[model samples]
Target: MDRVHLNPPPAADVAERADAHSVAPLLNCLLREAAAPHGGSRDADGRAPDDGRRVYRLRGSGRLLRVLGERRPAEPEMYVSDAWQRIGHAELVKLVADELRRHTGLSNHELPAEIIDSRNALAALLTARARATAPDDLYLRSEQSLLTGHPFHPAPKARGGGPVATWLPYAPEAHARFPLTLLGLREDTVVEEGDTSALDALGEAPPGYRLLPAHPWQLDLVGRELADAFADGRLVRLGTTGFDTWPTAAIRTLYAPERDLFVKFSLDVRITNDIRRLWRHDLLKLRRTDTATAAALAAIDGPAAWLGDRGYRTADFAFEELAVLVRDGLRGRVLPGATPLLAAGLVEGFEGSPLPGAQDPAAWWEAYLAQVVPPALAAFADHGVVLEAHLQNTLVAVGTDGMPVQALFRDAEGVKLLPDVSRAAGWERLVYCLVVNHLVEIAGALAAHHPTLNPWPAVRRELARHDLPEIPALLSSPTLPGKTNLLLRWTGADGADARYLPLPNPLAG
Candidate 1:
């Protein structure tokens, strides 16, 4: 398949010659320059940008260039002298194409006017480049150092599908749930084995902990001791069930014999479909939005207290794998717990209840926003954290009274904060997760139950009257959640006694 890559505006020699101007063209130029080279500097190889691409500032030019992968046109002295042009934007574009040509052995060329002007085309190119450059290798690292929800890390030796393992902390309530930060690991230093004694020579087991190997189908590698103990009767047992995300495996055993608890593992390749199932939900939700980019930008976290209040834990993370873990966990595990909240418990049919999808849209909206939303907003503020508050990622755990009791948030990997930066920025993703993904769901529910809220102009007027936070200003400010959801149920809904209310989206108005 044909793929595209964008280059930043080239050196003065190149930009002085073109006639067009726009951020898109500037980004294209920057990418090209970064792919080039730096003449003389200690950090000359040019570091990749936080978003995973090399951004190069030209030595003598005000323009910049960002290069990704090895697919540039191979003709040297490549300049857009005739058919194309550059744009002037707030972000300075750097140039390092000289370095890129040296690395990829590909020459540069000016894209046709049509390609250069189309935002969708440029975006598609960037996406293709990212995919082409993805490394197929992985390794082990501190889970704490990793982003809250990554699938794998770039390990030096743990590549090409060898024996895998994970030192996951045990959670009694959920299969994949673990402590906020700590995990159990083997005490020995051996990463590989050579002889029969290799099995027996495994690292010393930690006190009150065991090692379970990652059967080919498991998520993380487990400790050996824990696996064996689970086989025998030495470890106390917890319930075992097949995970939808990791269907190829079984929870061989989860034991809590006396001190501390441990989980055992085994795999069945058939389970890989779990990831597909979860991904389907993510894509479905993503497809429902027309303003995804804007929505994502609005959800970044800003404070520690806000994060803590909302039950979020912020820390340095491995960017690439975190989102995978969180997304999968949310759709396949956490949200299912809130099933009873819907009227008649009907997902696809039967619509006679008074909830969001029921007959009282206005009442539902007033009641929901009035009671349920505040707590979630405050919880995040108290902890100084930004959560992926998208609808599919959140759960409104309702009680028997048909009122919301607790807001169960899943996908820990998607949590982020303002004033904090990682390989991936927290702001945009935070917004997308919350407002884009979640707010839309809430709006839909309200529309179904409260039609008055759907009028765009009126809703905007009411929102203004409500004194909602200024989204544009807030986008740049470091902020936190201002309320919390303590899993409390609501009552006084005509005829309904008490039930769990849907947790208000933290990013919504």
Candidate 2:
């Protein structure tokens, strides 16, 4: 057999592929959150078009735009000179920047640049992915397969505007894996909370110091700032771990197969809506949030589980900067023989997704709803825990038949307590995260695969099984809160401060 040769595609081909991957998410944000429906374009019955292709008028520019494809917009065209002109990724960025400038009465120089960087990053990922061999484990393959992440963020692939060479070696998209950098912090400077026993097993530290593992990429970014501490012997480089860890979709989090543990680090990099560093405020409240979620999951009556963020370890001198979260891995929580795959990967698609090979699409979808919906709702109603059950945070385990048997949710940092936030606010957030962000994307992907199947009725039925007072309104509400990622970045809002615009609710019918 001949060996396969991996070579970079021509620059033009890279540009075209990058545009294909990046434009859809930006257009979805623009059309859903920014554009107004063209006048008199509603169907005869006054219903918005159900077809993926639709026409809209940009609210700011007042320009007509036509796009084909939904969930992930494609074939975007702008009406110019009384004719439709296809817009490339570069032109689309300009169009979006100009529209935002007019719509908000403000200009953002950084967002547009990030948009460019996002497209460039996608191009690099595509080139690297083509040459890379996917991991044999289906779960690992799914974890690393998100080429077009978020599907609604303008800059889903941006890496803090860094060069490709600087970040690609650790990129999950590139199927890269490397050992974690380890350090020995002086014992007096070690700060920790909860059970971080997993860290103790990574490597041994000297009598005067404790072991602290760090993401090498993060160390590279902040090394200069830490020269003083190292010089003073407060921090000692202990080299790297003996075993390698795979970076999950959330780039900062790595999965150590040997230990069956997840280590989340604080990296000063802007991924989608925020610089994804583990903030000091979040770290301070970590134990309380994780405890609430763990108890809620314990009360849940089924296999649906919560991967507890057991605890964290960091140096007191650089607490948030060097903090690392220790999370329970899949070995114990997941059912035996059932493989867990990232829910986002199921939507974005990968080499061996159960969605395409699903024998009974309707039954498969129902089984999925059964596994995913109840736990999230129960956590809210019975317990005050509001889970951020969006795609990336959720994992579905399927048995031999490829039918979903369990749902596991992670990320305590994103959870919200009921009494801390008003009931109404918590309900709205739960709805947005579980319904708009999670179920909608999965439903769309299922519908796309089996066009004849209608996914919302099953979802409505699954949600109706719950006794929450909000269910009736959720099913009948005319609109859902669609996150305004484009405007959020353009207006320089806090990433955690989510804003929304009304999007037509398919479940309303």
Candidate 3:
């Protein structure tokens, strides 16, 4: 395996580039929802006025601002001391904090800290990525390639305030691979649901015990909390797995290539919005959600597949704290010979992304929509299973020519059931996840890479082919719901409680 440089650049260059990558997304969110652009002129290319630079006033504070870069804002400059001054990452954080405070009429100290932490994490990732080795498997490289994650989230890279050393080794961005910590739980104390038979193949437990595999990083974070369980004879350490597992974009889920399995653990730390723990409420409903989604996908008439969550196992005493989910790996679920790549990575860009090198941007965009959109819609209309089909939860499998051939969706925990919420509510969630969060990002990336291409007409055509009742309204609606991650975090709302603001709908002709 060839090792890529994961070392920091010259100190000055590292800080400057890292700041641009980190603050761009934060500025994007602020400008989109909370600030108003003014005195902007279009360039000769007509991409955006002033070479994608614009002046704006914060809606709440009415403070003047100037920034370069569109889609993802960069090189932010704030009007201070009667002139436009370039702001570093720290200053950018302060600007966001001030703007958000005035916008919401609420003050939050923690969010600013997280914004700073996220930027710091980006710096570390940039340095480490320069020195890290990309996996030989293109699929794995795509899965691990997200350096600037959730391009719209203010603090997407914050790792619950942990030191860089503690989280860097486990970060997918850092190209990390490590063995799982295996444990044996007394049979009487083992609580499991669904078919967790695959776990038995990882390692054998002594008689009267069941094998449990844990993420080493999670173990370190919660070690002291679990000392009593270890001492009480309920849990016994059985050493780490012989084979190493690679972390995916979602840090807590590990892919074990040897066994062809995915094990999702409950990490008590907050990654983006909520603590990444498999909460007791969600764990209790996992089986039902997974079953519904699995059945829904089974009924879809295309190559789209659902990677079912087979089952979960946890200690009775520490249910949420110790729960581990077993998910179906790619071998059986993914199309044979088709390479599956993370959709998020495709949008974020990786070495093998079909998006950039696409021979026909129109055809490629259409194929992508063909694979990703139909199943998600079918699952909802036919089986009432609302898949969280956002970029991260979706995978686009490409053929030898690097054109999208199939779509595979995962993470049953994020699936929502029908009637549990009104049809109207479910449709809103679907539109936001499928269109706003997933497709729009991909379309933007495609257009940015290939300027002559207009990705939306194809998107409109694809949606028109579908007969869902929501299609008509979706096409004509002037605005689409854009989830307010910055505000959501600032207000300390439940992460699952998605609140969306209206965003101009590109599909509206």
Candidate 1: regions farther than 4 A off? 1-186, 189-216, 219-357, 375-383, 399-406, 421-430, 445-469, 472-509
- Candidate 2 lDDT, tens digit per residue, 194-225? 99889989998888999999999999999998
Off by over 4 Å in 3: 1-3, 6-8, 39-49
Across residues 346-454, which tens digit of lDDT does each residue of candidate 3 receive? Answer: 8889887788789999999999999999999999998888999999999999999999999999999899999898889999999999999899999999998999998
Tens digit per residue, CA lDDT, model 1, 43-124: 2244333433333444334234333322221111222432113223212211223333443454343122222322222232
Stretches > 4 Å off in candidate 2: 1-5, 39-53
Clashes in predicted model 1: 122
For lDDT, candidate 1 versus 3, the one ahead is 3
* Residue pairs in clash, model 2: none
Better of 2 and 3 by lDDT: 2
